[model samples]
Target: VGAALAAAPGADEAYGGFVYIMWGEKANCLSQVAHRNLETLLSAAPNARYRFFLYGPAQAAGYRIADGLSKVQFQRYAKRGYDVHMRLVNARWGPYAPATGVRDAWADQTNVGEDWPGEDRPGEAWWYAHRSRFPYEDKKHSKLKSVQPHPRDAFFNAVVHMYLTGGVHTDLTVAFSGLEKLTTGAEAQYAMYGDGCERRDAAYDDIITEFDGWDVSLPMALYFPDAGHPALKCVLDKYDQAVQNLSGLDAMERYCLTPQAPNGFPFYHEEEPHEGDYEAPPPAGMAQLRPGHGACARYLLETCKAQTELQDPAAPALKAMTVEWMGCDAGFHWDQWRFPYAASKPFRELAAPEGFDAAGVTGVWTGAALHGKRWEEPPEEHFISKEIYRAHPATRWDHPALKAGLLARQWQRENAIADVEDADRVFAEDPDFPKCAAALPACTSFFHDFSELKDMQYYREDAPKSPRNAAAARCSPTLIIPGAEKGASTFLYSLLAEHPQMISPLKGAGFKETGAYLAGFDRPGQLWDKTSHFPLIRENEPFLTGDATVINMVDKGAAKRVVRDNPNPKVIFSLRNPTDRLWSAYRFTFNVYYKTHLPDLSYANIVNDSVDGFGQCMQRQLSGAAAAAAGAAGEDAGDAEIE
Candidate 1:
C-alpha cells in the first residue's frame, strides 16, 4: 500500500507542486515562440514541477521538445537544491481513476456510422468523451441543449487536475511569470485571472468597460492552494453529470441539441419554456438542479458563474482573489491578435482584454492553446515575430494608411515598384490592391484605369490574340497524360520532353500541367491557350505539346474535355498500385503540408497512431461507391453485397 501510494503523483514534496497546462488537439508541434516562452517559465520557476497535457496526434518533434526539456530541467534546479520534473502527458489517458472503468473506447469500435433518425441508442463512454472535447451542438432541432463553443474538455480537465494535484492550472499559452509568488503561499487558496469574467454591474464589482456580463472566471490561469477543494469537486461533479446526460441521448437526439448563446447573452431556453412535453420552468435553486436532473441547466446558472454569491457550504472559503497585474492582464493575450479588427486599438480598449500572461510587461503575445478547427491548416504566423507584432497592421495609427503601407511593401517585394508608373502598374495588378484601396484615404484617386492609355500606345504590327508559339494552329496540347498521382508522372513527362518532336511548356508556364482544366477553369483566360505556354517556340515548327496533369486521371470528365479541346490528341495514363499510390500520396501530403507545421511527427507514427479516421473515411467512400455501382447496374443496393 505504501509503495503504491508512493508511486502516485502529488505524493512527494521533492517536486514542490504541479503546474498543469492543457495543449489542446490542434497543436501537434510546439512553435518556436512557445518553446522560448516555456524555457523562460521553467527557468523562472525553478521549484515548481510542470506537466503539459498534450492532446491529439502530436508529431515526433513535439515529443522531442518535451523530452529535451525534461532532461535539462533537472540540471537547472540541481545547483539550487530543488527537485525539477517537466514532462508531457498524453491527454488520452484521461483523469478517471482505474477503479472506475469509464475509459474512452469509441475509437476501437468498428462501423459506428453517422447519427440517423432511429430509436434511443445511448452513446458509448468514448462518445461522451468526444462530445466533451468538442461541445458545439448541431442546432437542427427546436430544443436547445448545449452551451456555446466553450472548451468544456479543457475546463473540466483544469478542475480535475487542480482538484487532484492541487496547484496552478493554465492554458498552454499562459506563462508562469508569477509562479514563485503564487506557489510560495503568498496568494489566497483560490486565485484566478479575471480578464475573461469581468462584471460590469454595480451589484457585482464596478470595473467599467464595454464587457458587461456573467461573473464567471475562465480556467485559463487558475490556482488552488491544495487538492480536494470542495468547490473544485462541485465543478467536477456538475461537469460529469452533464457528460452523463449527453450520453443518455441517442445520436439523433444529440445532433438536435441547439447551442446556447455566448456566456453573457440571455440563454433563451432558460428564459422561455422549451417546446412540447418539457414545459416546466427551470429550477432556480441549486439543490433542485442536481446531478441526474438538469446538470446543464445548473452549469449555465451556477457552476460556470463565479461562485462568490453562492451561499452553499461548498462555496469557496474566500472569494477567489483576482490576479490583476502587468503580464497577467488579459488584454495582451495572443488570441485577440488573431483578427485584424480585434487587435485594433479601438477593440483592444473597448473589448476589455481577456487574456493573461506571466511574462510581465513584455506585451508580446505568444502561444495558442484553444485548438478548434485549425488542425487542417496551422494558424498564420503574422504576429509571432517581434517585428511583425510591433508592425501589427490592425492596431496602427490610422489603420487604413498602415494597412496600405504594409500592402504596398508586400506588393513591392513580389513585383518591383521602381517609380510612380511601376507603382501604378503593380498596384493595378495586385489582388489585395482593390480591398486595400477601398479602405485607404481618397481611394478613388489612388487607383487609375490604365486600359485606354495602354491601348493608345500601339505597335506597327497587329498584336496576336495569344502568346507567340510555333504556329497559331498549335493552340492546345496534342498530347494529354491523365495522371495517376505518385506514379512517376514527372519522371515520365521529363523523359518525353527530351524528344525533339515532343515539346513541353516552360517551368514558368505549367511545367507539369497548366492545371486550368483540372481547376475547372476551361475558358479563354491566362491558362487557356497553349500558345501562352510555348511562348519561345519558332513559328511554323512541327512540335507536339503535352499536358501531364497527374490529378486528371481521378476526374472522370477530364478525357471528354481534353478530346473536345484537341482535334488529334493522344492520351496516356501511368497507373500505379492503389495501395502504394495512397501511401505515397499520404507521405507526399504529410511532407508538403504538415511536415514544416508538425516537424516531430513521423509518417510511420501517423500510420501507426490510434484513430483510423482515414480508414473509416475510405470505408464510407467504398461503401457509397459500391451502392452507386449496384444502383447503376439496376440492382437493389440494399441487398447488394459491397465487396
Candidate 2:
C-alpha cells in the first residue's frame, strides 16, 4: 500500500498528492487511538495530502446491509450528494472478505450512540456469517435458494452505477469472481492466527481455505475442521450423500467440508479474540451465534442545495447513498441480506420535499431484469452500453474534450451566452478574478487513481503548476489500435502494451473498447476524473500513451471523433480476412458468453444471432476519408435541423 503511494508523481516531495483511503467491508476502522496515530502524520503533512473516501456507501452500493445511520440519516446522506464513480462491472456471486476486514469479523468498530446498528451489524458483511450455516425460523439463504445469477438485480446495480456517473463509467473493470480453492494444513496461519488466541493445536488441525474474486491478492478466508480426520469426514460425507448433483457442487462440498468437529459436535464457528486490543479471547457467550431480525430502507432524495460548487453547476450533481430485499449470496453474511433490492429502493424512488411527489425510479434496464431478455447485438441495450450512441450521434466526445465538456457547460450556463461560436470562451474575465502567471501542465496520468484534484477547479486557466487534473485536452493515450474483433488485436495490443514505453488502462480491454467518442460528448468531468477512471502507469513519467478500443474500429464516427479531438492522434487498425475474422470471433464470442451469462443460450442460438446482423458489431468501421471527415457534418446537420 505504501509502495503505491510512494510511486505517485511527486508523492515524495513537500507537496505530495497521494490520498490513502483506509477501508474494508464492515466498520472495522482502527480504534480512535490507532486512527489518531495515522491521522497525525496526515494532519502534520497538510500539503503532502489529506482525504479519505469514506466507506459509507457500502450499503448504497449493494455490497452490504445498512449498519450505520437510520433511514432518515441515510436519506439525508444521499441528499447531501456524495460522489460515485461508475465503471465496467462484471459481478459474480460468492461470499468473500476484504483483507482489512478480516479483523472486523472478530469485533466491530462503530459503537457510538444508541442509534447504531447493534452488535450483529445486519448491514455489514462480517455479521452475515450467521446466515450461512444456520437460518432463522422464518427465512433462509436466497442465493442458495435461487442458484442462479441475479442479472436483473445486477442491472439495477449497473443502472444505479450509471445514474451516479454522468451516464458512462469512467473506465471498465472486467473482474470476475468465483475463484475458490481448498487448502490443507500448508496454508499461512494456524488456530493461533492473529485472532488473539494463544498457540493451540485446534487452528492447525483444521482445513482452512479461501474464496476470492477479482484481485487475486485479496481472498475470503474460510476455516473448517481437518477434512482428513475420520470423524469429521463422516459428517462431510453425509452432506455429500444428500447433495443430488454428484458430479457438481455436491462432489465439491463432499471433498471440501468438515461438517462437524472431531468430537461429533455440529460445526462450530469461532469469533476472534475481542478483548481490548485483542490480547484476550472472546468469552463463551460472546463467541456463540445468535439470531435476530433487521429492517432498513433507502429513498434517493434529490440533492437539494448541498452539491459542491464545482460539480455540474446546472443539473444537481447526481449522488445516491442507499438498496432492497435482494438475496444474500452464500459463504454467509447476515449483514448483506437482500442488499441489492433493499438498498436500491432509494435509487429507484427518489425522496421528495414534504407534500411533494417522489421521483418513481425505474431500472436502467426497466423491465428487462424481470423480462426474459438478453442483449444479443447492436443497438446496445444499456445507455452507457453502445446503442445510445447510435440513437444520438451528438452524444460522443473524446476523453480530453469530455473533461472539458463539464467546464464548457458551466461556463455557458453562468455566462448566459447562447451563441454557439462563443462556446469555447472563458467566463472568468473579471479583473478581480484570480489568476496565475502561467498555465500548469497536465498530469498525463500515472495510474487508475484519485489525486488531490477536486471538481472542476483544476480546469481553470491558472490551473496548478503541476496539473491537478492532467489538463487533459490530450487524453494520455498516445496511440490507438482499433481492431477487427477476430483479428489479432488482442495479441497485437498485448505485445505492444508490454513495452516499457506503452501505457494503457489497467482494465485493458474494458477501457479500450469503450466507444466513448460516441458517448463522451457532454459527459461530466467525473467521467475522466481519477475518481471515475484509472491510468495504467505509476508516476507522471510517460514514454507512450494510447488505447485499443476495438469497438471504435466499427463505429466509424468514433475514429472520426478521436482524430478531430486530437489531430496528432497515432492510430492503427489490425486487419484480417473478413471470413476468417468473423468465424473466429463467432466461436470465441459464443464460448465466452456461454460461460458468463448465457448458460441457457446454446451454440445454435449464438450461430443464429451471428447470422442475423449481430455480426455487424464486428465490422471495423466504415472505410474511407468520408467517414473520417468526423462528426462536424453530422453534428451540424442535427443542429441545423433542430434550429
Candidate 3:
C-alpha cells in the first residue's frame, strides 16, 4: 500500500491538501501511521499543511474511543486550519442513524441532510416513513405522508400516456408486456403513483406486471378465440375493448379512461380528409385493377368475377370466357417478350417484326436475323462447279448422243458423293462417334465365311432356342429406381430412360418402400419373391427361368410401381458431412415443419432442443435401419453395398 502511494504520480508534491481516508481493515491500522507521518512531515517542513480524513474502518476509530481521543485530535487539526473529515462506510447506516441520533460525521461536513432532507438517514426510517400508499394520502394535512413518484417513473408514465393517446397501440402493447414488478418499496412508489390518467394507467400496469412472465403463446391463443383458446379470447377481448373505448371518446376523456387511449381506436390512420369537393380521379393510364393476363390469366379472370359478384348484386354475367381468350392472347405475347422458348420461332424474329438487318446490329449474325441482311432476294446460284460436273462420263459433251438420257443419272451420282464427304467430315469432328467406333471389335469375315458354316442349317432350325434370342425377347423389362429426396435418383432415372427397355414410373410414388423391403431381406429368395411379378435381368441364364423372372422384376416399370405403392418407402439412403447434414436438418425442421406448428419458436430454442438429444435420436434411427439391412445381407457382404 505504501509502495503504491509512493508510486502515485502526484504523491511526492509538498503542497498539502485534503486527503481522503478509505475505510476497512487496512484503514484502521493505516490511519494512525498516516497521522503520525503527517506530524513528522509538518515538523520537518513547517510551511506544508496537513489534513485528516477518516472513512470506513478509520471513521470507527473516533467512535471506538470512549473519551474520543481521535475526535479531539480531529478537532484540534480543524482549529489549526487543517481540514478534518469523517464519513460512514455502511450503506444501511442512513435510516437507523437519524432515529438513533448517531449522525455520520461525513454527512455533517457535506451538508447532505440539508441537501437531500432525510435521504442520508437509514432505510428503515427514510423509506418506511415516506412509502407510497395504495388508495391516497395527503402530504400537507396528514402526519404520515405518502411518497411521491420518482422522476424517472413519472417520465416513463408520461411517455406511455403519450403513446397510448397518440394511437400507438403496438407500442403500448409491447411496453406493458415487458414491465416487471419492482422489488424495492421506493422503486414501487416511483413506478406507480400520482392522480388522473397516470394513476388509472398504474392499475392496468399492475395487472400486466402480474402476467408478464406467462407464456406469450397462451395469451396469444386466448386473445384470438377463433384460434380456439379461452385465454387468447380473454386477452383479445380486453385489447379490443381498450381500443374501442379510446376511439369513441375525446382526447381528454380518453386519457381519463386509463391514461391510455380508449378502446376501438386504431393506432394510426390516414390524416387527410376523404370527403371533399376537390376529390381527384386516379392518375392517367392507371387501371382500376390489374388486367387479367400472363400465366395466371385464367385464375385472375375467375377471381375478378367472384369479386364482382360480391360487390354488385345486380351484376351481369362477367363474360369470363371471352375475356379469358383475350387474356390468353395477352399471355402469349407476354411470354414471348419475357421467355421466347414458348414460341416456334426464335425471340429475335418476334422482336423484329420488320425484316432483320444483322449488319446494322453490333453482334454476330444469326440465321433468323440474316433474312434481310445477307440478300435482297434468293441467290439461285448452284453450289457445284461445271468442271466437276463434266468429270462424269455420262454427262460429258463427248458423249452427246447419250447426254439427255444420262443427265439425271449424272446429277444423282454427284449429289451422292457430296453427301458421303459431308458425313465423313461430321464423323471426324464428333467426339463421341470416334470413341464408340474405337471401342467396338472389327469383324474380318461375314456370317457366310464362319467355321460353323456346316451347322448353319441346324442353327436356322433352332434359332428360338438360343440364349441371345431369349434375352432380346425380354428386352422390354420394368425398371425400379429408388431414391432419397433431392438426391441423384432423379438424374439417374432420367439417364436410364434413354434405354428403350427401361420404363420408369411417374414421380410422387413412394420410392422408400423398396429400401425398407431390401433392409428386411433375410435371403436372396425373399428378395426374389418380393420382386417376382416385376422384370429383371439374369446373368448367364435363359429368360424363361425363375431367376431371370426375378431379375426382370427389378426393371424400370417395376420400380415405378413400387414407388406408387409406397409413398414414404426408403429407396436410397444418402447422407452429407455431419455439419452440413445438421444444417440442412435444422433448415428443414424449423423453416419447413416448425413454421407450420410453432411459428414463434426462436432459432436458439430449436438449436438448443436439437443439441439436448433429439437430433441424435433421429440420426440413430436412420443408421440403425442401415445396419440391420447390412446384417441381413450375410457375413461376406461388404460394409458399403450399393445394391
Best by the lDDT measure:
1
- Provide the TM-score for each candidate, comma-separated: 0.34, 0.28, 0.16
Clash list (residue pairs), candidate 1: 59-601, 60-600, 60-601, 61-600, 330-355, 331-353
| Model 3 accuracy (lDDT, Cα) | 0.25
Whichever of 1 and 3 has more TM-score, that candidate is: 1
* Top-scoring candidate (TM-score): 1
Tens digits of per-residue lDDT, candidate 2, 174-205, equal 00011011111122111100122122222212
Runs off by more than 4 Å, candidate 3: 1-502, 505-513, 522-525, 532-592, 599-609, 612-643
Mark the regions of model 1 whose C-alpha exceeds 4 Å error after superposition: 1-15, 24-33, 57-92, 97-150, 186-219, 243-322, 325-338, 346-643
Residue-level lDDT tens digits of model 1 in 453-546: 3333211221222111112223456667778888877778878866544555432223556563454434333221223333222212223457
RMSD values, in order shown: 22.5, 23.9, 40.8
Candidate 2: global Cα-lDDT? 0.27
Provide the overall lDDT of each model, using Cα atoms, as 2-decimal numbers: 0.39, 0.27, 0.25
Candidate 3 lDDT over 414-497, as tens digits, reads 332221223344455665644543332221110112244233332111221122222222212223333333333445544543
Ranking the candidates on TM-score from highest down gives: 1, 2, 3
Q: For model 2, how big is the CA root-mean-square deviation?
A: 23.9
Clashes of 1: 6
> What lDDT would candidate 1 get against the real structure?
0.39
